[model samples]
Target chain A: MRSSVALWAASLLVYLFLYVPLAIVVAYSFNDSRLNAEWVGFTWHWYQVLLHDEDMLQAAANSLLIAFIASTCATVLGTMAGLAMHRYKPKLLPFMVITPVAMPEILLGVSLLLFFIQVLNLTLGMLSVILAHITFCIGFVAIVVKARLAGMDESIFEAARDLGATPWKTFKHVTFPLILPAVVAGFLMSFTLSLDDFVITFFTAGVGVSTLPLQIYSMIKIAVTPEVNAVSTVLMLITLTMIVLAARFAPETLKARS
Target chain B: MATPAFADLLKFRLHKNLTRWLVSGPPFLFLLLFFLAPSLIMVLASFRYPGEFGGLAPLRDANPAVLQGLTLETYRFFFSDVIYAEIFFKSFGMALATTLACLVMAYPLALLIARSPRKHRDLMVLLVILPFASNFLVRVYAWMIILGPQSAFAHAIGSALELFGITPVPLLFSPVAVLIGMIYVHLPFMILPLYTNLEKHDPVLLDAAQDLGANAWRRFWDVTFPLSLPGIFAGSALVFIPVLGMFAIPDILGGTRDMLIGNLIKEQFLGVRDWPFGATLSIMLTLMVLAWAGFSMWLARKWSHSHA
Candidate 1:
């Protein structure tokens, strides 16, 4: 009885440690004081500043567009990779798909930065950033989809083929419906990752382009204001909504990433 | 025509081969172009010279006055300049420290969650995941607020130290603040893997240990801890390696004296505009990570073999 009580207390403390800092950030967003040191009368002014700030607005638009496109492409390619891995069991495909996901983000960021300038001679902007996001995001989507595929009975796919359904027809009728949740889950995850990404975007996004993370990073580095706190609160809510919606589709996405 | 059945079989085989390529080829091609080619470019970039102004020098048909063509100058510089290696050592120590802190903090929570009722387990895990799901920067930013001089938490720690006749140290931008940020950002990565491993453990073993008169501490140390080696490895890899290359936490929270491998690499690319040096530092970091990963896997294998 005592040990269980001790375990419960320890776990609760850990949970509080995880959450208290974030709760404080959210609370200070409403504090009207520019100093942001103590409790003050609640005001919506910081959020208002975030909404009207021209730079923040532009960065948000760029982040949304890049995330939408990158996640879409990554989903298609990553789904194909996942399907191929489960069905074909290609040796090289798994290595290529998983390594980029596991390595440090900065390595990929700088390597791509070099590749763009040196080999492709392509100018860094929205296109380069989206392409970079898609490259890493593919690995994540593939892992989730592949995990979903791994659990199912192989005979079902074989059964579809035995019924004389064409390859495309079998996938369309049998496989697609079963894995649709995972696919949607992968899309949402890719969207979140791309949106939250900073290091890769930092390196590949030339002077002309910016994203929300880049903007927020600059804000915190340059000055500390309740406005950063407000922007952070808003970003947290949007992410929470995305993850909850993703959980509804496939709870396994969270597990797979972890 | 030959036999109709034979002809049909040949066509079906051909179609299977086509489908296989069609299914696998696009993603394979995409990764090859984007990931593999870029990594190779980085390897090549490390061997090249910095241009007169910045970036990589022209490889072919270069002006004699400008730095051009591939050379080993960056590697030589890295060898001669002792500071580069010092930074690498500091980053490794920091990674090790962060990994250890996360392991200690996460184990208790993971144990509780694993022992919890099955239905409630997912929700508990979700609670842990929810905070981390936000931008990691914002998560790091939270530390900045709590550790700032005016915050009650920092003041409390500072005042407590003064009672012992020690000076009240400034908290923000110190190594301690960076370490806290590192532990905060990475604790979940440790918890999830350990929980997954512990959840699969049979309650039978603990019962058997208790039957043999082993107490709780002995039972855990002798049985449960040994069994969870693979989980420890996975969790450690997730936490340790990323910490090795993290810059933002240090950049935002670190004082003037604190610099890690990630900051050094970032400076070369973005601040210094020295592409070759940046690529060299990246390659070195990758090699070190690979070596460490390889060593840990070997150790885990030995532990498992002995336990088995």
Candidate 2:
């Protein structure tokens, strides 16, 4: 009993340590004052500002667009890769497929940037960002989907095939249904990763194509403002909600506790 | 019902080589061109030097005009540079330290959550993981706001400490800030893995130890800790590798003054336009990660084999 109490208290303090700063940011987002700390009154001034901030809005739109395209592409590619890796006996090759993930972002960012500019002669923009994102996102999707595949009953696929189903039909009818939850989970994870990407996007972004993270970073360089705090708060809440939903609804294979 | 019909269609298609190739060809080709080919290009380009006009023109010593014969000049340059060497060593050291700190911090939290009565564990785990779901940069930025000079918490805490005759500590843009941000960002990575492992542990083992007259410390050391090593390894790898590659936290929290190897690589490619050198560094970094990953993979295989 005593140990449990100590544990709970220590954990609670950790929670406060983790969340207090964020709470302050969220609290100040509604502050009527421009200053980050000072709270003159409770008003949605920054929220209102965000409503009309064209640059921020456009950056947000670009971010969503990039994440959507990139994450979707990554999900499809990753699902296929995962399916092949899990079903086939080519274990060593899949490691190479996922190696891009372990390579440092700067390394990847610079190499991809170099490849694009010097070799491919392509300008950076949504296409470059999406490509960069897919590079990393594919690995994430593959890992998650692969883990899910590992947990699935291998006999099910074999059983489907034994009954006279073709490989494609077996995957579509039997394999695909079992893996759907993991695929969704992987997609969400990829989307969030793409949405939150900065260093890679920063190195690869062209002059005019700004992401939300880049915008937030540049804003920080100028000065920390309540509007950013508001945006950060909103972003945090959305992500938190999604993660909780994922954690709760995730299949046994995808659950962290497993 | 539908399963048999689908299976029949799948078996019918499997008889045709064209359909099999069609099913497998695109993903294989995609990975081959985009992933495998690009990495090969990076490796090849790392060995070549840029020529006049700042372009990747070829060196004259090779059979193919564009391909240069192997040169270790890039590697030599990176190794010979004292600043870069220091940055590389320091980044690894910091990553290791951060990993240890997160493990120490995470152990108690995970134990607490795992030990909690059935009703409370889920809530506690949910709260613990909530912050990790936020944008990684925003969370670090939140730290910046809290630790920065203008922080109300900083001022208040400093004043309160002064009342007790203790000097206020300066925290922002220091290594301390980097450690704080890293631990905060990665604590969940550590906690969840440990919790998963610890949850697998049978309480009966502890009871058996007690029955054998082992003290709690001895039991944990002899039984629990050994069982938990895999989690520790997993958690540490998750935290350390990413932290070594981290550019943002050190950039924002440490104010870009304390440059790590990641920053050095970024500077070369983006700032200084030294593509060959950056590629060399990237190759080195990739090699090191692979080496570490290989070691861990071996360790895991050995452990599992022994257990089996």
Using DockQ, give the best candidate's number. Answer: 1
Q: lDDT of each structure?
A: 0.92, 0.78
Instruction: Give a tens-digit lDDT track for model 1, residues A63-125.
Output: 999999999999999999999999999999999999888998899899888888888999999
Query: In model 1, what are the clashing residue pairs, if there are any?
Result: none
RMSD of each: 1.3, 4.5
Put down candidate 2 lDDT per residue, A171-224, tens digits, no spaces. 789988888887888788778889888988988896859988999988876777
True contacts kept of each: 0.70, 0.42
Tell me how much of the true interface, by contacts, candidate 2 captures: 0.42
Question: What are the iRMS values of all candidates?
Answer: 1.2, 2.5
> Which residue runs of candidate 2 sit more than 4 Å off their true CA positions?
A1-3, A244-249, A252-258, B1-21, B51-70, B156-169, B298-308
lDDT (10s digit) by residue, model 2, range B37-103: 6677778767878544443656565556564656777888887878777888888888889999988
Give stretches of model 1 more than 4 Å off: A1-3, B1-3
DockQ list for all candidates: 0.76, 0.49
